[model samples]
Target: MTREARQEALERHGLVESGDGFTVTLKGFQKAAERARGLRAQGNQEAALMLALEPSDPVRWEYARCLQIDTFSTEAYESGF
Candidate 1:
Protein backbone atom coordinates (compact mmCIF):
# COMPACT_ATOMS: atom_id res chain seq x y z
CA MET A 1 0.00 0.00 0.00
CA THR A 2 1.01 3.58 -0.53
CA ARG A 3 2.07 5.67 2.46
CA GLU A 4 -1.28 7.46 2.46
CA ALA A 5 -3.21 4.21 2.29
CA ARG A 6 -1.15 2.69 5.08
CA GLN A 7 -1.67 5.71 7.28
CA GLU A 8 -5.37 5.64 6.57
CA ALA A 9 -5.52 1.93 7.38
CA LEU A 10 -3.73 2.55 10.67
CA GLU A 11 -6.19 5.26 11.59
CA ARG A 12 -9.14 3.19 10.49
CA HIS A 13 -7.93 0.46 12.80
CA GLY A 14 -7.47 2.90 15.69
CA LEU A 15 -3.70 2.87 15.71
CA VAL A 16 -1.66 5.85 16.82
CA GLU A 17 1.84 6.27 15.49
CA SER A 18 3.37 7.09 18.81
CA GLY A 19 6.43 5.76 20.66
CA ASP A 20 10.08 5.56 19.53
CA GLY A 21 10.99 4.75 15.96
CA PHE A 22 9.30 1.63 14.56
CA THR A 23 7.30 1.12 17.67
CA VAL A 24 3.49 1.07 17.83
CA THR A 25 1.46 1.32 21.03
CA LEU A 26 -1.87 -0.22 20.08
CA LYS A 27 -2.23 -3.85 21.06
CA GLY A 28 -4.50 -4.54 18.13
CA PHE A 29 -1.96 -3.13 15.71
CA GLN A 30 0.81 -5.16 17.32
CA LYS A 31 -1.24 -8.31 17.00
CA ALA A 32 -2.15 -7.57 13.42
CA ALA A 33 1.49 -7.00 12.54
CA GLU A 34 2.52 -10.24 14.15
CA ARG A 35 -0.20 -12.14 12.31
CA ALA A 36 0.69 -10.44 9.06
CA ARG A 37 4.36 -11.21 9.50
CA GLY A 38 3.59 -14.84 10.01
CA LEU A 39 1.40 -14.91 6.92
CA ARG A 40 4.05 -13.15 4.89
CA ALA A 41 6.71 -15.61 6.07
CA GLN A 42 4.44 -18.34 4.81
CA GLY A 43 4.24 -16.62 1.42
CA ASN A 44 0.78 -15.15 1.85
CA GLN A 45 1.52 -11.45 1.73
CA GLU A 46 -1.81 -10.60 0.13
CA ALA A 47 -3.78 -12.39 2.79
CA ALA A 48 -1.55 -10.90 5.44
CA LEU A 49 -2.16 -7.38 4.22
CA MET A 50 -5.87 -7.98 3.86
CA LEU A 51 -6.04 -9.07 7.47
CA ALA A 52 -4.23 -5.92 8.50
CA LEU A 53 -6.33 -3.55 6.39
CA GLU A 54 -9.81 -5.02 6.66
CA PRO A 55 -11.18 -4.58 10.15
CA SER A 56 -14.52 -6.02 9.04
CA ASP A 57 -13.00 -9.42 8.25
CA PRO A 58 -14.29 -12.27 10.36
CA VAL A 59 -10.74 -13.47 10.76
CA ARG A 60 -9.74 -10.19 12.35
CA TRP A 61 -12.68 -10.41 14.76
CA GLU A 62 -11.79 -13.98 15.58
CA TYR A 63 -8.20 -13.00 16.21
CA ALA A 64 -9.36 -10.26 18.51
CA ARG A 65 -11.57 -12.73 20.34
CA CYS A 66 -8.44 -14.43 21.63
CA LEU A 67 -6.77 -11.19 22.62
CA GLN A 68 -9.30 -9.31 24.73
CA ILE A 69 -12.43 -10.05 26.70
CA ASP A 70 -14.16 -6.84 25.68
CA THR A 71 -13.75 -7.86 22.06
CA PHE A 72 -15.97 -10.89 22.42
CA SER A 73 -19.29 -9.06 22.51
CA THR A 74 -18.48 -6.68 19.71
CA GLU A 75 -16.98 -9.39 17.56
CA ALA A 76 -20.06 -11.50 18.00
CA TYR A 77 -22.22 -8.71 16.72
CA GLU A 78 -19.80 -7.93 13.91
CA SER A 79 -19.68 -11.54 12.90
CA GLY A 80 -23.43 -11.42 12.29
CA PHE A 81 -24.03 -14.76 13.96
Candidate 2:
Protein backbone atom coordinates (compact mmCIF):
# COMPACT_ATOMS: atom_id res chain seq x y z
CA MET A 1 0.00 0.00 0.00
CA THR A 2 1.00 3.61 -0.43
CA ARG A 3 2.41 5.69 2.39
CA GLU A 4 -0.79 7.67 2.63
CA ALA A 5 -2.85 4.54 3.08
CA ARG A 6 -0.45 3.22 5.72
CA GLN A 7 -0.51 6.55 7.54
CA GLU A 8 -4.28 6.53 7.42
CA ALA A 9 -4.33 3.14 9.07
CA LEU A 10 -2.05 4.41 11.80
CA GLU A 11 -4.18 7.48 12.30
CA ARG A 12 -7.31 5.35 12.56
CA HIS A 13 -5.67 3.52 15.40
CA GLY A 14 -4.86 6.76 17.29
CA LEU A 15 -1.18 6.72 16.40
CA VAL A 16 0.02 10.21 15.68
CA GLU A 17 3.08 10.82 13.57
CA SER A 18 6.20 12.00 15.31
CA GLY A 19 8.13 15.17 14.51
CA ASP A 20 10.19 13.25 11.96
CA GLY A 21 7.00 12.71 9.93
CA PHE A 22 7.92 9.06 9.58
CA THR A 23 7.48 7.59 13.01
CA VAL A 24 4.73 6.90 15.52
CA THR A 25 4.56 6.05 19.17
CA LEU A 26 4.31 2.30 19.62
CA LYS A 27 4.27 1.85 23.38
CA GLY A 28 0.51 2.02 23.67
CA PHE A 29 -0.01 -0.43 20.86
CA GLN A 30 2.51 -2.84 22.34
CA LYS A 31 0.97 -2.60 25.81
CA ALA A 32 -2.51 -3.19 24.49
CA ALA A 33 -1.41 -6.18 22.47
CA GLU A 34 0.44 -7.57 25.46
CA ARG A 35 -2.62 -7.15 27.60
CA ALA A 36 -4.76 -8.88 25.05
CA ARG A 37 -2.34 -11.76 24.91
CA GLY A 38 -2.38 -12.03 28.66
CA LEU A 39 -6.13 -12.06 28.69
CA ARG A 40 -6.16 -14.80 26.13
CA ALA A 41 -3.73 -16.79 28.21
CA GLN A 42 -6.07 -16.39 31.15
CA GLY A 43 -8.97 -17.79 29.15
CA ASN A 44 -10.79 -14.49 28.66
CA GLN A 45 -11.58 -15.33 25.08
CA GLU A 46 -14.17 -12.66 24.49
CA ALA A 47 -12.13 -9.73 25.72
CA ALA A 48 -9.00 -11.07 24.15
CA LEU A 49 -10.63 -11.39 20.77
CA MET A 50 -12.11 -7.94 21.01
CA LEU A 51 -8.72 -6.41 21.66
CA ALA A 52 -7.11 -8.58 19.02
CA LEU A 53 -9.50 -7.27 16.39
CA GLU A 54 -8.71 -3.61 17.10
CA PRO A 55 -7.18 -1.56 14.27
CA SER A 56 -3.93 -0.99 16.18
CA ASP A 57 -2.48 -4.29 15.05
CA PRO A 58 -2.91 -3.48 11.37
CA VAL A 59 -1.42 -0.04 11.92
CA ARG A 60 1.54 -1.58 13.68
CA TRP A 61 2.11 -3.95 10.81
CA GLU A 62 1.92 -1.15 8.30
CA TYR A 63 4.31 0.97 10.31
CA ALA A 64 6.79 -1.87 10.57
CA ARG A 65 6.57 -2.57 6.87
CA CYS A 66 7.18 1.07 6.08
CA LEU A 67 10.29 1.02 8.22
CA GLN A 68 11.60 -1.95 6.28
CA ILE A 69 11.40 -0.12 2.95
CA ASP A 70 13.90 2.45 1.67
CA THR A 71 11.63 5.47 1.34
CA PHE A 72 14.17 8.20 1.96
CA SER A 73 15.12 8.68 -1.67
CA THR A 74 12.34 8.03 -4.11
CA GLU A 75 14.05 9.98 -6.87
CA ALA A 76 17.23 7.95 -6.66
CA TYR A 77 15.31 4.68 -6.89
CA GLU A 78 13.22 5.89 -9.82
CA SER A 79 16.30 7.05 -11.75
CA GLY A 80 18.32 3.88 -11.16
CA PHE A 81 18.38 2.68 -14.77
Candidate number with greatest TM-score:
2
On the 0 to 100 scale, the lDDT of residue 24 in model 2 is 32
Instruction: Report the CA-based lDDT of candidate 2 relative to the real structure.
Output: 0.49
lDDT top scorer? 1
**TM-score of every candidate relative to the true structure:** 0.30, 0.31
Q: Give one digit per residue, the lDDT tens place, for model 1 in 1-81.
A: 556755554454434454632223356555655656676789885646556556766666545433333333344346553
Residue clash pairs of candidate 2:
none
Worst 10 residues of 1 by lDDT: 64-73
lDDT of all predictions: 0.51, 0.49
lDDT at residue 65 of model 2 (Cα atoms): 34
Residues 1-81 of candidate 2 have per-residue lDDT tens digits of: 467766555554435556765443464355445555676789986545555565656754453334323232333246451
Which lDDT value does model 1 have at 24? 30
- On the 0 to 100 scale, the lDDT of residue 22 in model 1 is 28
